[model samples]
Target: MSDQLVMIIDGMPHTGWKEASIARSIERGPHNFSLQLSEIWNTEKQVNRRAIEQGMSLQAYLNDDLFMSGYINELAPSYDANNHTISIRGSSRLGDLVDCSTTGKAFAGQSLLQISQSLCAPFGITVHVDASAKKAANQIFNKSKRLDLGEPIWEFLEELARVRAVLLTSNANGDLIITRAGTGYADVALALGQNIKTASGNFSGRELFSQYTVSGQQSNEPSVKLESVDTVLPIATVNGSGRYRPFAVAADDDMDVAGCKTRAEWQRNVNQGRSESVVYTVTGWRQTPDGRIWAPNERVIVSDPYQGLLNAERLIVETRLMLNERGRNTELRVMPKNAFDLIPEVESAASEGFIR
Candidate 1:
């Protein structure tokens, strides 16, 4: 059976169509898809409109394997004297979590799994936390004057993931998944003159700080200070005095010197990696050597002399796939594998609730 792309709307599978594309972008949030069909070519225009109005479910599959499943969230039909077509767009079940809000609720001393399950239960979504991930109790409120939980459920969960240095994403089956950031690596390598059609690398230290000093101040007391430095690049080589980045944390019921320090260190590492990133546009959907589909949060070796990178394995942070009249292609945004990986010392302390 050859590879095929199809979209099912209201229980009807559509393979032969004018155009279709699925974009799974974990870094920017929920994955989404779009389909465009001509009115004269089929009856999808009418069926799609009815589905959109009635909020019918939609699912997409590649090679009969489910890739994305969600409800039809948008519909735009067009018609003229010489043309007739309809456009449909939708997002995964994670979109519902982003739309749902939690009000007048407080979650204290609850594990990440518990919080995620509680928030996603109302939307009929399942939560799956990686076994290797640390489950720590956190505090969140929806009605407190000091802490308002008026934001969407996804936003709340994202904040929780950020503090713990984990990643919150959805699988192709639309299950909410929480895992370590940049932990998955593919065996295939993306090499120039092999599969990569174009490549570019960017490096800059303008936003990076060689030294970070984090201070936590309590009521009428001297502030407790913690410092972290970017050891990847020496201060003497870059600047003698060292570029200082100061972070002040207001002491709260949950704030502590240790938590403040953890935040400072995580921020420093993130910024340092962000200072240098790469983007590669490849020829097809999968790596040439293994035919593995390109996905986010996976590491792949990139070899390109033009970009000054030779067989450097980087983390695939984002991926964009397009299949239309222009043909099929994939674009990848990558960064150092250690970009989001926390320092061993910081990771251990943060997992122990030393970080908020």
Candidate 2:
């Protein structure tokens, strides 16, 4: 603890709170938290239905570091003849994006940056694009539309991010960020015998399709067929070895045979890379040695023999932090760097358990 944990409710800092936890993600989703307070003798510190009705805003800080800022979305109070406590659950500013529905908008030739800026303007968020983002600032959206059925702005933006191999996240100051996946972040090494408390590794080939056949069909054009196979070294010798698993795809529009082949190959490589994953639980909120905060999208070095991993560099795809009266801990979900380059899956088989 850096002696700077502060929880502000409606701009007023309150002390003596218990059992607080905040969760943030790089998936362009909402960050949320749960807080508990004792109401035994503090009449002025009680949170009740009135607070919920008034839409109480919340801001949290850890030693000069902004942890969470949002509004109270849910409130629950529990009282017994012997004990008294009030618990509140809420989300961050991203909640506004998740709840607001958009009425079918068309961006015939607008760049992704322009579209994101326009969409996030209503929420009072500034959108920042990384210099290394795949799509240029002026690149036009050839054809994109929000359906008439209406959907959350966050959901719509998430779809675009997926297709473009980009990530959307918010900074400590509550500004929106659009950047390429796994880029623009520093790598932190997590030594097994040092700061890491517990770790587990899991690898699966159940859904690994060793072969893919793609067929591209265009209006008034001949159908073209292409095949892609998994032969990327190390991975080829392990989970994908001797497995002739086959999958197929039907590409729409004017995709030629070469394009289909490239797409299939890319998909095969990504799936192969994602088959293996590692989960690490560290003691502190930040990585040891450097004291930098652990965040998603950054790279980390793992050296643990119990998991059969040694001096391996991996990408941090997800991170979860838990803070309470006891202590603070961080959990990280990591995968091979290649996993970040694959195209997002739009659909998948109902049953992926069978190897064939």
- Candidate 2 minimal-lDDT segment of 10 residues: 347-356
In order of appearance, the predictions have TM-scores of 0.77, 0.82
- For candidate 1, give the lDDT: 0.65
Q: Write the per-residue lDDT of candidate 2 for residues 1-356, one digit (tens) a residue.
A: 45445777887776556677677766546677787776553345543322332268878776566766778888777675445676888777777888888666666566667878888898787788777674554465555544334667787777666555577776655667777556544445767887678887777776566567766664443333333344353454465456666678776434666666667777776776688788888876766433566777777777888876688777787777666765777788888777667453322221111112
Q: Give candidate 2 regions above 4 Å deviation.
A: 1-4, 15-17, 42-54, 147-149, 184-187, 218-240, 288-290, 342-356
TM-score of 1: 0.77
Scored by CA lDDT, what does every candidate get?
0.65, 0.66
For model 1, how does the per-residue alpha-carbon lDDT over 134-177 read when each residue is reduced to its tens digit? 44323332222111356677766776666555678888878888
Q: How much RMSD separates candidate 1 from the native structure?
A: 5.6
